[model samples]
Target: MKLKLNQLDILLEVAAQGSIGKAAKALNLTQPAISKTIQEMEAEIGLPILQRSSRGVTLNEYGQVLLRHARDIDRSLHQAREEIDHLLGKAMRQLRVGFTSAASYGPFTNTMIEFQARYPGVKLVAMEGRPHQILDALQNQRLDIAVLTAGTSIVQSGMYYEPLYALSNTIIAGDQHPITHTTSLKSLMNYPWLDWDEPGEHSILAQVFRRYNLPQPQNIVHCSSPWVMARMMEQADMVSMWTSVRLRFPGYNVNLRPLALREVLPATSIGVLCPNIGRLSTAGNTFLEMLRINARDWLQQSDAAEMVARV
Candidate 1:
């Protein structure tokens, strides 16, 4: 039984996203198309390879075994293509970058600005989405890399990552909030809260809340955009937990304070992840290098200084 590589790619995507609908969106194929393709592959294999569950997509034993060989095939094919491109004297000039909104506002922007300064000739295609969307794009070959919260669930073979910066979780309330100086958890639980829980777009504050064994804040509003979040913040008495990196942008009338929980929030690093390392272009490689250097030299140092002052 011979399975097509495209079918394998689709399977990997569905497995990563845990949703056929999202995989279809990333592949520019309809749900029926993706499902049929996977079904066709399963037919050829003469066994059930994948399964769906509330927890997300998971691979059966055969699927896991096949995934390893399928990834090797992908890597070999990628290496062959890279070799041919190199022989043709081709260098990458067009790059597709994906990031979450917070990443774009933070060091992800800085990394791109620095790359542009060095490789001004490279054409950049930038796409933004919540974390899962970005991962889907990367998996579907729509993007070469994505900036997202580190230690995500988008695991696939041959994927590589670079840690860019760490972010602090703080409750961002509007200026109307009466608790400006209050860092105590008891004080913070008094107000309304906001959260963003799009697929794979987990917030650092969620972990903080869990660590303290605290209940969800009393009142709550949900937002998907920084701008919308900002607007809501201005118009209502909402206190949402957000990353310091995001709040650093423009005017978001937020009163940021460290709520004295049982322990400090375990900061999540924002990482630039190449969902496919086997296919990195030369320009992408260069951009990755510059990102690493900037993270080490500039972003981390500045963030450290800012942290010392805040603490």
Candidate 2:
């Protein structure tokens, strides 16, 4: 079908705003003009794209399909413009990245610093969120890459995961916690606990308790924000499961200490996720290379530290 770019733009705006009136206001047009554009698009496509109701307009199945393609086209056009501007020396290069809390505590931050040093003109936009949030942004083309912890079985079809390093989970408690020196997992049940796992899913801490045939802590608070969790753990008598690497960080180490538990928690893989290889911009490719180099150096250093500890 011969649909104009403006038609797609109207459809996207309407879907975003949830009504023709709101879309029109945002686009600086009248409600009827937006309605007519929608009607024209539907007539050209020979299908109803939206389902109208008393509340607001919602995308029908056909509209959902079309919206996906529309978003892809929109992203391509934006990327094309950016590329052309860079070629003409009218704009600086930019890269958008999303990362999880765990990734931020490790080599990812170092990689970003190294990238910035190498590409001084490249603008780096980094966002921190949960793994699912980061992955969603990457898939929607809002982000060029995502750094998060994932297992091998958690792969997505159109994404490539380049593993950086393995991270071990550890139990942490504030230094002043009553049972901070306790080695028994059962002792922790008497105090309140903090968990970062999504509701309805078994957390690594729960799994560790299960492995020992111990009952799960009853008074547990579920949270996903690392900053909140850290503050709560420091001020309250709460225990949490956190990455060992993070526990060693300067800010975290001030108040939090890894519990000396004999049980070892399973390690998870931290990696960089992106669209299929060879699809990134020049700046993105260079950043990815820096990540690889930093990750390699971090792993070797970690191994040497372990050897020294053993000796």
Candidate 3:
């Protein structure tokens, strides 16, 4: 009932290392000492916490439940220490952000620069990952905020989503690709297709084909990394769907161009995802505010440009 912080720390270490001996070594303690701690914890909780076997150990049902709370406590304690350090001027504050590659251009990058300029003392850590990976990190408390493409199916409950901009999606290929001049999806099926992995029954490209009652492309490569996808597109004749905003970014536009297809792809929105329960730190909130401002400006500019094109 009254588990101490050290007890939770030992439990976490045991769960992480998967063996008492290994946990003891990691914690700089004897094997028997680690065993005794585990026994005491089990006695206090009135249930076995771990299952031991020849292949080390694994957390049981009760241990798995406790492990989640233990990690939360660990993160809370670390944040407390960081806040104290910041107040004492002993260390710089830090913010951890996870974002999808599609969200890495234009407004997102601009907000990052502006945030850094405004909060020079806060250290910013940014990680690039697929949308699902970024959302998982945010749920696990590994990241403070996530910037990803907003999809109703992809955003889980218990997270707050703020719509940023509805970016235009387009099929793109290397400028030299033979099919680059093709105007219809049906005509491009003979060429290899590169698809970004999305969390759904079908990818956007596949959905588009299905909507038109066309057969799905036979030669398709599912890719997760944007950099790898870009490199592959540049080196091969493969075509892929990407956001217009991302395609406009420097390295991409240099070698890749949107195919002039008559098909109008559905626009995808980029958004900010954060904990809805006010878990964000002051620094995190400031960065979120800057993102909102930049997104507003970017949306306004996009509207004006669309109007000009129509004129």
Candidate 4:
């Protein structure tokens, strides 16, 4: 069956919004218009796609399959447009890169600078987002490469990843926080804390509590931005866990200090998540190589310093 791109787009939007009226509002079309489009698509395909009820609508089995192909088609169209623009000399070679908030503060910044210097004609589009959002973009082909904290789910998602460095997370607070002087976990619990906006079951804070056999800390604030967390700690008697490396970045709350704990949290893995390396554009591949070199250099320097301190 032949279907128009607009029809497929409408169907995808309806499935996403789960309400015809909401989808119409989002797409800026009338509800009747949207209904007609869906009807036409169903007629062309010879099967019902959506199951409607009093509450809203949901995709049936057929709708699921159609939505998946629609997304693939959308990606292809975007690539085709980019290619045409490039051929017309209207677009520069572009590499879209995404990074988790923590990844942005490190040598990745230098990698971007070096990549730009090496390929002066390439256009860079960098974004900072949570790991899940970055991963979604990578899977949808919206981003060329993403650097993020490597988690089990990321490794299991079937994406290609190169481990960059290992980071140990520790509780941090304003340098002047009274708890910084306290060596006991009990004393540390007296202050309110902040945590990343993650599920409690999967949170580093929860893991710390379990390790110490302590009750969950009270008066906690959940924040998503590392900058927000740093600002809060600078202004209040709050605590939160972050990569030790994150705390070391210049201009990232010079007043923040890692709490001295007898317990050591497991190190987190940081990595580059990407599609097949062979599929990346020349600009994308060049930037990826720069990332590898920068990561290796920083990790080696850190190791050397640690060894000297030990000696």
Best by lDDT: 3
- Give all candidate RMSDs, comma-separated: 17.6, 17.5, 17.3, 17.6
Task: Give lDDT for model 3.
Answer: 0.80
Clashes of 4: 0
Q: Rate the local accuracy (lDDT) of all candidates.
A: 0.70, 0.78, 0.80, 0.79
Global fold similarity of model 1 (TM-score): 0.62
Per-residue lDDT for 296 in model 3? 68
Give the lDDT of residue 288 in candidate 1. Answer: 79
Q: Put down candidate 1 lDDT per residue, 21-51, tens digits, no spaces.
A: 8999998999999889878988898998888
In model 3, the worst 10-residue window by lDDT is 302-311
Worst ten in a row by lDDT for model 1: 253-262
TM-score of each: 0.62, 0.63, 0.64, 0.63
Residues 1-311, candidate 4: write the lDDT tens digits: 89999998898799889999999999999999999999998898999999989999998999899999999998999999988757644323788999986676456888988988877888889988777778889999899899887776777888888877767777788987877463656677768888775655446677677887998777788777878888889998888888766766667758888788777666667789888865666677677788888876776675423311111
TM-score for predicted model 3 compared with the true structure = 0.64
The true-versus-predicted C-alpha distance at residue 147 of model 2, in Å, is: 1.5
TM-score of 2: 0.63
Looking at model 2, the pairs that clash are none
Angstrom error of the Cα, residue 74, model 2: value is 34
The superposed Cα distance between candidate 3 and the true structure at residue 54, in angstroms, equals 91
How would you order the candidates by lDDT, starting with the best? 3, 4, 2, 1
